[model samples]
Target: MQLTTFTDYGLRMLMYLAAQPEQQCSVREVADHYGISRNHLVKVAHRLSQLGFIDSTKGRGGGIRLSGEPASMRLGDIVLKLEPNMHIVECFDKSTNCCAITAICKAKDFFRQANQAFIDVLNKYTLSDTIVSGKSFLEIFALPQPTNPDRHKQS
Candidate 1:
């Protein structure tokens, strides 16, 4: 049940922004910090901005910042917005699925249940919860941090 790279990067970008809500960030900075492509981050940033997750500014001294509070941003909702499709199996998309056993397949029900369970877990945590939970997540996972500490100092 792996998510696409688009969704993966989208979530990462959101987490980064949520962690430093007091400051604005740029796609180049985030991409360099994460060792990812700036082009990809730009596309993700554009989509996120369009979806009302982040606000963008142009020209000198301009950057992107979160449009809303992190506590109100649900992980499940973000995933659903970033991911173009969530079908785990061919039968999940009835419009294109021509599976012969889709009508009576118990596996389809199991898959549906599994997907729901996955979403349920994500729904339990919001961006604020991830940061405020006080858990040791940094040690377990390697994530990006701003090179310039002052870049995120409260304005």
Candidate 2:
């Protein structure tokens, strides 16, 4: 099963915040550092703030920071919340039955098991746990920049 960009960015956003535990990171700063889209990060930050993962403050010297302890924030829980409809296959959705033999499909149960296993693996690591190493983490991921040079420039 593939995660949507929303979930992908959500995780990255959390990782960025997790990296700077002592500072209040602005959406713009995080976007600039990662070369990610600030617009998209805004949405992710807002949702994360609403979900109690991050806190936002307005005014000078104010920005966003992680609310709860990172260890307490489970990756699986964040993914589940960010990704509302995580149906791996059409049959996974109750309304859409694409398979002809879903009723008697033993494979469906196996798929369910596999999905649960996937979640279990995610649960094994929190945002802090994921980025505990440092810049090496960033290097390994090869995360995209917020602005791609190939895009049009008004200048």
Candidate 3:
């Protein structure tokens, strides 16, 4: 299933924060790094902060940082929180479902199973597991190189 831009941006924000555990980053910084809309990232950051996924501070010398350890942040949990709904078919939403075959659609069951499998696979991994190497990510994403590469290294 295709994820909404909101969830996609939320995940990107988390990954960015996970990579720079020692430094707080502004929403604009993340937006610029990913070449996305700053306004959109602002909303994403705000939601993430509200959800306790990131800690945000305002005013001078204030920014955002991961609130919890990356290794302890399960990808499935993150996705579940960020994703508004996991409906894969029209029959999935009971309130709005108007499909003619909803009564006998075995496809809905299969879709549900497939969706659960997707989440189950994601549940097996944590944020830390997704980051093969922060340095490589920085290089690949064209993010600014830290003054001290050693500082960004995972311990």
Q: Candidates' TM-scores?
A: 0.81, 0.81, 0.88
User: Candidate 1: minimum summed lDDT over ten consecutive residues — where?
Assistant: 132-141
| Candidate 2 overall lDDT versus native | 0.82
Query: How would you order the candidates by lDDT, starting with the best?
Result: 3, 1, 2
Model 3 lDDT, residue 138, Cα: 61
Q: RMSD (Cα, Å) of candidate 1?
A: 8.1
lDDT by residue for model 2 (1-155), tens: 99987788888888877776677878998777666689988998899888888999988988998887777888999999898788887788988777888888888888889988988999998877988565676564476536568644556
Tens-digit lDDT track of model 1 for 26-79: 989778667677998999999999999999998899899889999999898888
Global Cα lDDT for candidate 1? 0.83
Better of 1 and 3 by lDDT: 3
Top TM-score hit:
3
Instruction: State the lDDT at 45 in candidate 1.
Output: 95
In model 2, the Cα lDDT at residue 92 comes to 89
Off by over 4 Å in 3: 143-155
Candidate 2 residues lying further than 4 Å off, grouped into runs, are 134-155
- Model 3 per-residue lDDT at 95: 89
Cα lDDT computed for each candidate against the true fold: 0.83, 0.82, 0.87
TM-score of predicted model 2?
0.81
Q: What is candidate 2's CA lDDT for residue 98?
A: 72
